[model samples]
Target: MTSLPESPRPAPTRAAGAFEVRLSDSPLPEPDRRALIASPRFGTVFTDHMARCTWTAGGGWSDRRIEKYGPLNLNPAAAVLHYGQEIFEGLKAYRHADGSVWTFRPEANAARFARSAHRLALPQLSAEDFLGSIEALVRVDAAWVPSGEETSLYLRPFMYASEDFLGVRATQQAEYLVIASPVGPYFAGGVKPVSIWVAQDYHRSGAGGTGAAKCGGNYAASLLPQQEAQSKGCDQVCFLDASTNSLLEELGGMNVFIVGADGSVATPELSGTILEGVTRSSILRLLADSGHDVQERPIALAELRAGLADGSVTEVFACGTAAVITPIGRLAGADFDLAVADGAAGRVTTGLREALTDIQYGRAADPHGWMHRLL
Candidate 1:
């Protein structure tokens, strides 16, 4: 990477923070860019520019700039490679019908990113800085935001130790970056009911672990269980609490919810052992606002299975950033298999999915002031 100009260049200013966005000398041709966005795959390609900033004890978060997307020449001894001291967040930019750009609940992602940074012993970047990076990056590559149905520009903002130290302590230097990718629908065939494998041999997070943080290690720990789930003819893995293995914690990558026949919605309460999903929180609020009795409490595995068996729990679904709402049709383990009514997406599940996506894709009113426009 080249050094910032001796004198700062003209920059865009945000209410909270501002940064200079330097255009790339060699940008992708418009034709190729259009063709790629026509049918893009997840995480397979990147935009022309990236937003970045570095932090140090003496210098603070200086040299804020949006530079060309390229490889990093990190030293072999970087602490992150060996010690894994990093945090990251995922959100998306959408193209509305009138050619404006927006994102859903970005402030929540910024808040969670700050919480993850604190948990990882990384520097605390203000919410303004976080939102600035996303807005700035999207503003630079505004064309990459796709306009097709269920298409978006995925934004991944991550920070890691830049210090080339082998010590096991938090490094004094770190680098924050935001990159973008054009992605089509997560499920090309449309949202369908999926089967889940109950993880009998593994736990996603332990007591007092990095469960609530959006760190890489937490996902690394889930890979094995996810692989096992895939091998067991299931679309995902349902993780139980590590201590008791009875109380439901979460799925491998999504928060879970169950709807009963009595117009009640219940999900596993936050116990510091599951991800605080933005989609999960929004769905809960939307359900409660629609006059449903929403409960956040410890949901036991036995309770879920018995409800399914008795036809009381009519619907089950998972939520995350990628696939907003995924219906769970069957729960399979070594000795038991429980299926929801008709093994199809239930009314409550479909209603919640529509309610959330309608707002996300600009089809419904955002009464909660969650959508933040970028362009």
Candidate 2:
């Protein structure tokens, strides 16, 4: 199987050009919109508009538009339907007390989106273009940005092969889109320590596979394992490295972290087999800033299990866009269950979560300028 070289990309511009904006003729009634935002669910409900851009072999990326949110008209034999050439990203739009909307590390998301596109043989949406598309969509649906507590507008940017074909090859046509949902919290009970299930029977992705890419195929492969994890009463599944199945790679959708009694923190290093999480990177910086030794190295499952038995590792947690920081209260498998810090959210976990959320919600000073103002 041959791979397509990345097409020469155009210089990215801010989302300030004369972009087309077509408002919905029949948007959701204000009464319903207000009620919906009061207690919004995750990912199911969408805002009034979406941003779209198309890419073609000869034309590059063009035809950008912000139109009403609705179902797409995909061909019966679309390449994405068969070949699974697709990638996506997840981030949030936070509403501050001063009525400004901001997002954390959008440029990081854009850069990672481009990396995922490259790995999947799809056209790279410029960082400017990605940020601009997000800005455009959020601008039209500004009212949909939820407030109070940890509520925010969840943004999902995705791209997939749109060409109609039966045989497997590089994508000739693709579509990039941005849609948003008002969400309250990822874990229904909010940020707390949760249990983790160790997947001993399956591996997420192998060496030189799409494990590191934020693509649907990698997630699709983990569904069965995730089902198993849930059946075992675990909130999420922990996957080991595919090559050895001993070193900790990451949680199904989030990154894993461990803290030691020596006031040190560490997470699984990027081994080309795990998705590089934006939140995970931020936590490392914050940990170092808070006078904790931060380590980014391969973590062995045996060491983690032993650390729990001993007192080397005092806390364990998971980090991602949806669930900012969830402490792993328990690590359970078929044969054994290890209690983590008396099955409670630890000090390190809570402090890190607070620091990150503070920067996100404009409660604290953003020294890194990570928040990009969408409105």
Candidate 3:
């Protein structure tokens, strides 16, 4: 696994903008807004406000603001549209049962966001600054936070090159913005096993590519394969290492994990070509805490199939910020089909899911201090 270096402690907190709060006049209707917040779907409905900060090579970062959520009048020649210089992060603010809102390991997400920015050649935001931006916005939209089961205010922090140039290079001018959506469950129904299409023709990232970064291009490249998976009646697609095409890499939007018949857990190690999902890392820690001998190493495709055949692999699941944990029922390729046991959530899989959700919903003890109260 890829171990993160010692994280530098952030300085004292400060007001995000430090200047006068420039409020937006364009706000949503109160009653309609309440209905939307009551059952907001994933990424479909958004909060009324957003946080944005501008960056320039010469002027550094501008004072940020909680602006009205609206369309961006981007230049037709924006570099993000041409050069594809963009990166983003996905996290959530949960309303605990005690009526206080909190988030899990937001610092980890903030750190990963910086790493992703560095990889994309974009300016990095300080951990404190990043957290402050989100917190500031969440505080403003505190009433928009949903209290339904498995519901959260999904925060999407994105940076994109806003320079109005068509040159095929990273731009010096960029804009970072955080938009929030009150989202319900990722899957429409309750948690269920999903079939995955094993993609062999197209790869999400190759050797020495920008795979680790949660950039827009990587997801754009997977659209075709993802559509193909949908056509095949699969819920998602799994990608293997681009070089060897044998070792399991990750799914389209989540990381994969396998449980052994002997009750051990295993997941593909970070090979610099797969996203380091926050949910995936947390699950590893949770599994170990539950006394499962977790292994993070290269898991060969052939070995997984063989293990499944011999009943050694008990369960398979995929995890990410969107879907906390989704069990895999089968893997469909062009020729052969690999089916997991009965297309059901395994004992270990469901147990970990419940445990993580418990912490998220404020039902379980947070021994690791992962929950940071926002309200």
Candidate 4:
């Protein structure tokens, strides 16, 4: 018997103003909205609307709109529920002193989003659409952008398989959505040093795995390890390379760095097992520009421990979109626990955080043109 030809897959394309805005009739009152923005509990409160779009295997992307933020009606057998075909990106919009709103390295996030989509077997979203969705949502909910120090509207853009079949393959239907939340500092009070528990047993990702992808499953795998960290009186968890189990990979949700006593710096090289963090890359650039010797190579656990013991490793820190830069003050494992350089925020860590945030909040000159104005 003759088989029918396969359907032609649509190529990814860019379009301006792809997300049609639909204003919410029941928006939160100004007083209530301001109250929530004054003290947002980091990802708990949402804005008035969300940006959404749909994609099909044969028809490509369609039905783009910004609508009321509400529940989603998904079939019980949705592919994302079973196969875990999902990817997400996190970024923020900063309100400058002059009332202008901007985002840092959004194009980088867009590129990474596309990369993640490919890894998750999802349709690639054009950078233009990725950014347009964010801009549209933020424009409609510009009131949600907070102006306080270390406060901004956090943008979460995610894509998931929406198909209602369980054939154990990539879904034919998918959905992409962008939601905004006004958030305070990722760490509650202020930027302070955080203790970390080294995961001696669990690995975040392995070689030939979805380690490099910014997907939910990777974060899901780290929850237990994170819980263990909290139980051990640490704030976060660190994962080592699965193959060697000695090479420092990264923290649960952030990239890590080791600052040497000689003013040199090093971070684990992109080994396809660590998410390529936008904040991590920006910090590297800032460090390089400031004349510090920056190296990206495998940072072994033994090396870090020895350096810490001998006072060669002056500081350790982690970086991500939410926290920007967090100093790792202590590292504990099954057999050993140690403080990192007086268990305080190091000079390099503080300086890097200030420099990055300065640029982000428009306090310093953006020499690299990394800031993208959204409003």
Summarize candidate 2's per-residue lDDT along 120-223 as a digit string, tens digits.
Answer: 99999998888899887887898999887888999999999999988888989999999999998898887778889999888888899998899998888888
Against the reference, the lDDT scores of all candidates come to: 0.87, 0.88, 0.86, 0.91
Candidate 1 accuracy as TM-score: 0.94
Model 1 per-residue lDDT at 229: 86
Put the candidates in lDDT order, highest first: 4, 2, 1, 3
Per-model TM-score on C-alpha atoms: 0.94, 0.95, 0.94, 0.95
Residue-level lDDT tens digits of model 4 in 218-297: 99999999999999999999999999899999998999999999999999999999999999999999999999999999
Candidate 1 pairs with clashing backbones:
none
- Residues 173-270 of candidate 1: C-alpha lDDT, one tens digit per residue: 99999999999766566678889999978998988889999999989988999899889898899999989989898987899999999979999999
In model 1, state the lDDT of residue 307. 94
| Residue 121 of model 3, lDDT score | 91
Segments of candidate 3 deviating more than 4 angstroms: 1-20
lDDT of 1: 0.87
Q: Tell me model 4's lDDT, rounded to 2 decimals.
A: 0.91
Cα RMSD (Å) per model? 5.7, 7.4, 5.6, 9.3
